[model samples]
Target chain A: MASKTQSKTTAEFADDPINASLTADDKIELLRKMVRIRRFEQTSLKHYHAGSIGGFLHLYIGQESVAVGSISLLGDHDHVITAYRDHGHALAVGMTMDECMAEVFGKKTGCSKGKGGSMHYFAPDKNYWGGHGIVGGQTPLGAGLAFGVKYLGQKGCCLCYLGDGAINQGAFHEALNLAALWDLPVIFIIENNGYSMGTSQVRSSAHPEEGLAARAQGYNMDWAQIDGVSVYEIRAGVNKAVLRAHEESRPTLLEIKTYRHKGHSVADANAEKYRTKEEIQEHMAEHDPIDFWKSTLIGEGVITEDDYKQINKEAGAEADAAAEFAIKSPFPDESEIFDDIYWEVDNNTEAGRTGRHFFHG
Target chain B: MPREITYREALREGLDEELAHDDNVVIIGEEVAEYNGAYKVTEGLWKKWGDKRVIDAPISEAGFIGMGIGASMLGIRPVMELMFYSFAYVAFDQMMNNAATCRYMSGGLINVPIVVRGPANGGTNVGATHSHTPENIFANMPGLKVVSPSDPYDVKGLIKSSIRDNDPVYFMESTVLYGMAGEVPSNDELDEGELIVPIGKAKVKREGADISLIAHGRAVVSSLAAADILAEKYNINAEVLDLRSIRPLDEQAIMETVRKTHRAVYVEENKPFCGIGAQVSSMIMEQAFDDLDAPVLRITSADAPAFYSPPIEKLQLPTPEEIVERSLTIC
Candidate 1:
């Protein structure tokens, strides 16, 4: 007997907060981050259509606020790992637009050196592990990070992001069970963007009504359900989880309800096949994260009409510059083929590249 | 000071020694804590290191394996043990896609210093579902380093090295050889630190001029036995080459053996089609073709699911008698 209003269960965690106070600067910055992500994705889609970008391209247009709000709450030392829809996540965690754009373009200066293409965007220096291509593949990796954090006595926690589609994977259950049993400092974030590829959560999951967060009680875990369209709510939910992780060494399952404005990927453009255009338009009008946040900022006197317009314009320009940088970047050299396979001693993967040249032998 | 030790004990000793040496090193798996490991390879580690160092994971291979990979990226060295390598099939995406590609795809920015060790060979009549020699499958991946040791001495030295190495190393052990004993170096005999065996290096267990018996894992022991028979009965000088590491491949060592013994006979417990032997034979024909006098012969398991029947299962694996017989043709 679960209700759609999110209060059917006693775990309406998004309503309250443990010190979710945000400064004016943090609010304005988060707003701009959302804008930057939306503009960057929009630009990538435009280029993908023009044949400038290749491969299965998934955009983080509708789900910008989730990544921005959640990551802003974590310290720079904390780690963030997510699924393939990660352009927004990478940007929110302070990845340079030029490097990310170059990565998607498969250029040499890309974060993954043009080898990982779009599905993998990793920056270990920034503590953003990478966006995994597999649906539930990165679940255990979060546990690993949390395990390391506890083992080394580091204060940093781990944030694991995944789509609603990944909830059904056994890795999710296994990871949650261990996370709870060990009381590790890891927060499992589920960005429920309505459909997993073409199938909605209702059709794919066994217990979809209670929200994926409801299953936390089974593992004796703490959980919250966030209205993902609201950046304020997203921030509140993550802030609470982070506090508990730091104080009690607890893991929480936070389900952020959101949607994808675009198709699953650039390849899946036929949105009309699954649902009506009216539903899409209605969601854009009512629940668009960017629009919702923009109105809040303007209403609260955070910015003027001119400021809002400028933010969008600047994000668009930044994305343009990134695209230019990526276009001009060179492809990797022929010698790069035999590198990064093994590490002999230190972090020198390119070692023995010349010595072990089997082609010469 | 070298002493006789079981492969199982030798593996446990490596885990114990590493746990004592590095605080970042942790052992994680099902039955590894209180259950003393499914095979008793980590019998006293949990008691020694306590719960924080030695952890027992849920029966979720994909989850814990991925967690191990994630932890390793953050400077934790996790030696994760699977009850059987067949269980790894559940976590293939994490093991192959994530663990193998993270370091290379990240432009060498991240390191996955995780050791996924388990019994990978088939001889226990555990049926098709439980038995899987997947070294070739893992070795095929570029960013991964595959290690399959033959004896207690090799297992003790190499498992320690696999733990120390800053890469994803798949350590393959055999259930049949776990109880078997071999001479291992004591602390006094070895360097001040643990014995470090280099990955991707093949060892010549026996010397010969007529033919080379190249193998890995349990097949190495069988090949050594086969070489003894070939020397005593057939009057053939058969060289036994133990390929401890599979991925970096040690192409130079393989070619050196091929040059020494012109005839080659490859033995593996994995299936024959597209197996490790196939790759070895292909490499020989490509690089060492000039030295080979005959076609590279392979004695692999029958290309089918491992049967539950003990006798049928025995026939499914590559045996010492079969290796000796196969070497006769190549010789």
Candidate 2:
């Protein structure tokens, strides 16, 4: 259950340090989340490179902790929905690696029964609504899902994730205003990678840093801006926003200033012509979420170097197994094109019949 | 025990009976509360149910309409009113994106049970922007269910049925016929106030043998008038079918009637080229080609704007005289 008491503010996230006496187990779990996301994306990136997967693939490489920390705060009853750049969030929300990879490969064993591909993954059992594609398209849908939560009297909130590029779309504004006016239980998180495709935030948006959160003011919503790369800070920022949403039946906006390690998609070369090599290297060294967590865990004696190798080895094995399973998994029957277009029956959905349960609830 | 009531009142009673019985149902739109709706279909609902149930909205069609989609996605039955049928364009994003695509796009995870109502079809001098019928525009979409009820009975029964349907329904009422009175049973009867006419079912107003006169929306009434004139004066028996729903058209009914009559005349209030009549005609020609004794005739308004000028408006919409003339030519 979410705490009714208001937590610390967005600025407070940067100020509050992890207690110096923190347990190794706690730090291990945090580091595990970071590793899980990193390994998953790396595997997916490898698959995309090998020409095994087709269609648009958006990897959440550097921004793994944003989803891990925020989703960790949510209960089983809570829901999540985001844009095409959604593998990290889906994995963090507990969708199996096999199904996620299968979906990317457009196999029968995939989530959405291979119909959704990368941009339209839906894990309803886990309360993950979708993997939408059209820039800001998922905002209104997220608001609707939150509205569903209120309508059914569910004691949970929906985390609506979008990109910095998505903020400029009209649906975002319409959804935010309506969510606040109705006081729907939703937390809107804008993952500001400082670019909407090739265009930088400065060129695309007039006030990029705070503009996303400021738009919430028209709806009188609680707003925050945070250093998104810092795992502890992102965790605190999301936890505070989630608390307000659960208790007050209100929506909050959080602007997470993060950077993407990979280029926009597998297509971009990330050539130094558009942006300096120094900037890319600066982000890799200074703001790499996984590196920061690994160092912190090691420094605190959370786990030995052996434990780190063991976890990475397990992740690699898991990714390899997932790839093997997806490759071996028969292509979905051509007849399956007609299936799952409209959901039928309550307990026996297609995803369940396939022995892949995205959500327990 | 039927009595006279306007199309608007019938719709109101239909909504009232639906909301009274179903706890999950609610109505939201501009002026649906204090101002009693622009067409007054939701009169006195706000004072009775309060703002929570009969929501009064700001002039944010895209916002509230999207809210309705969100509400429906969550399990609430929301009936949204697009102030004028013309203003429905403002919220097309919600209708097309969230309402129509949720089930297919979500890979069958969500069902959006939403009803958007307004007056469609031309006439009453609302001018070019406000007065053109665009139900055909939506009728072309694969996922949506489009309906245009032409009478008080249909307005009542169809609205009740649309409320309970799982798919998103686009219910277009008429501007000119909202005040047209007709027989509607009292609320005392068990099924009187609440009538569920299944979507995509055509109602045969009058069965005849000479020619099949098919129409919908305001044209249904116009076709019926033409049928009456043909029966009384020329003694030509023309079967008139009121096509209540447009998307999943009651093709079986139309094909059966065309098989009997061997000639067809489709009347529409919209312009001639590529209108709903064209689609209906194509379907008939494709399926019932051997049954046709003559070329299928279509009585539609001229291919021009629905201007404010009376004569131009008169030329740009189908009337009873035009339907009769077209039917006689087909006969």
Candidate 3:
């Protein structure tokens, strides 16, 4: 089976050295990550329906390659942040599946200790800033993360991801201007999944025929658009932006075209109302990032059909075990509610002890 | 002897000391670098430390403030200056949601050691848009710490403490009181150490037993004036208390003052509805209800958006006359 040709927009940077440097095992690992993320989302959604997991579940089913490909290129100083559809990024950045599943389950053993629900996962140690919920809220934060990197004199960058809907937010524009003017080492990755919740990109955003990344032109920053379905293409394009950020302390706006098979969230039952079932099916069948990568690896002889099946089996088992762990984990104790609200209050410092930190106490 | 400095100078001194104290502390905001500052509270520091230390951001409050919050999570202490605290509404979501909840949401894995400081009083006659006193609003949030200093001494000390705090501190100042001079500990007198007025503490501006006049920010100045009037004209002694920190409120100090005076009057520039006074009034009633001689009365700004006209705006905020009258009723 032949892999699809690289999109013309990303053709200039298609031959990224980072892709060439990946060994057979590393390439197979990327496939495994994508598979794991897919299985995780599927399992989480199952529990969501079964009433074990509560709140909204923004499944990152079809967009696994975007997180796995881009995050695999990050170095020690590099950081990543994304909007609510963040399980892929969280898993890609080395968060345990158990912790990620438990976080969504709202259990005490969760990454955020059951404080942040599905929309807010954070691993500062991994340089994964958060799972921000607001549309364009993380844009400024992404730039700020880069600002911290520059201030500390570290040669690293921050990858800030947002959806097509967030493009229209004033905060994103302001962040772009600041990132450009200050020469902050940050990459604004627009995960263009066509629709902003229910509204399609065409209805929610305004852009030239050059596409949404062209808005970067207004900020006097470099921009590119890429086919997000291919992990090879995502790495090829994102690697250039990362290199530019490291070497020149510059910012780039890279719009990666992708799709979500599920609705905005499990709560967004009207996902089928705005777009047709046929469009979703077409994307799932033809352009599924996981399936596309799986065939590409097979064609390249990196992994045989049997190896792919083994990998899928392992990923499925891991995801199922994570769900079991989440279900068994107890909810946070009632007394623990007052904890973690303020660093001072939790640490029992003079500032914390001096005042009434909690009203109830 | 302590030297007298304007409130603006006191704030600038605090920022300068912190910048010199820590390599991680940086000042960021619109016109905060080259143009001195919107209120000149950050004056001369830009030239002293250079651009990297003192950054001049675009006039996007949400962008810069949120950026500051992001930077703080990574160990950089950002002292963000909002031109007017009123403009905080422009970045309300960022301030209220992101900065306030980052610690709790991340389950204490991340700490936002950022300070957002600016004028937040309504008497400048900058109209309703510019003259918002939102100390009560920001104080209402749990994760955030709110500080509004009245005099130069408290401003200098509290600014330092707020910067050093490991949480998001909203330092509300007064444009009208920026030039007002009060005695501050001079640099030469700091042979002992740096002056740091701890957050969540109240200070007694004047001591008395007849009645207690409690306030924060510029209202403390008005309360002091009313206290003088109470002593000279009414032959009644009034104790004046300044709540330097609003959120981690000095409940002990408030209860003590209420217990001492038996009659108390809450004075503030914040609007009457859901204002700081309302919270204090409730606390007083709950803790010291039996000790109270009269119902705790509140003297707040008129329950409306600040008036644009100078005279009307002056009347819109709590005046010494109103404080005195309100105190007389309680006393």
Off by over 4 Å in 1: A1-20, A345-361, B191-193
State the TM-score, rounded to 2 decimals, of chain A in model 2.
0.87
Question: Which candidate has the highest DockQ of all?
Answer: 3
DockQ of 3: 0.85
* Model 2, docking class: acceptable
lDDT of 2 by residue, B1-105 (tens): 468899999999889888887877889888888999888889988888876679877777777777777667667898989888788787777777667666765
What tens-digit string does per-residue lDDT give for candidate 3 at B152-265? 999999999999999999999999899999999886688757788999989999999989999999999999999999999999999999998998989999999989999898
Task: List where candidate 3 sits over 4 angstroms from the true fold.
Answer: A1-15
Tens digits of per-residue lDDT for model 3, A339-359: 888899899999998767667
Q: Chain B TM per candidate, please?
A: 0.98, 0.96, 0.98
- What is the docking quality class of candidate 3? high
DockQ each: 0.54, 0.31, 0.85
Positional deviation of residue A75's Cα in model 1 after best superposition, in angstroms: 1.2
Q: What tens digits encode model 1's per-residue C-alpha lDDT throughout A244-335? A: 88888999999998888888998996766776788788778777878777777676677877888999999999999999999999988877
* Residue-wise C-alpha lDDT for candidate 1, range B1-331, written one tens digit per residue: 4599999999898888899888889999999999999999999889888988999888888988988999899888999999999998998988998888887777778878899999998879788989999988987787787889999988988898788878888999999999999998887786665666677677889988888889999998989998888889989988888988787677777888889989988899988888989988988999889998999998998899989999888988888888877777766
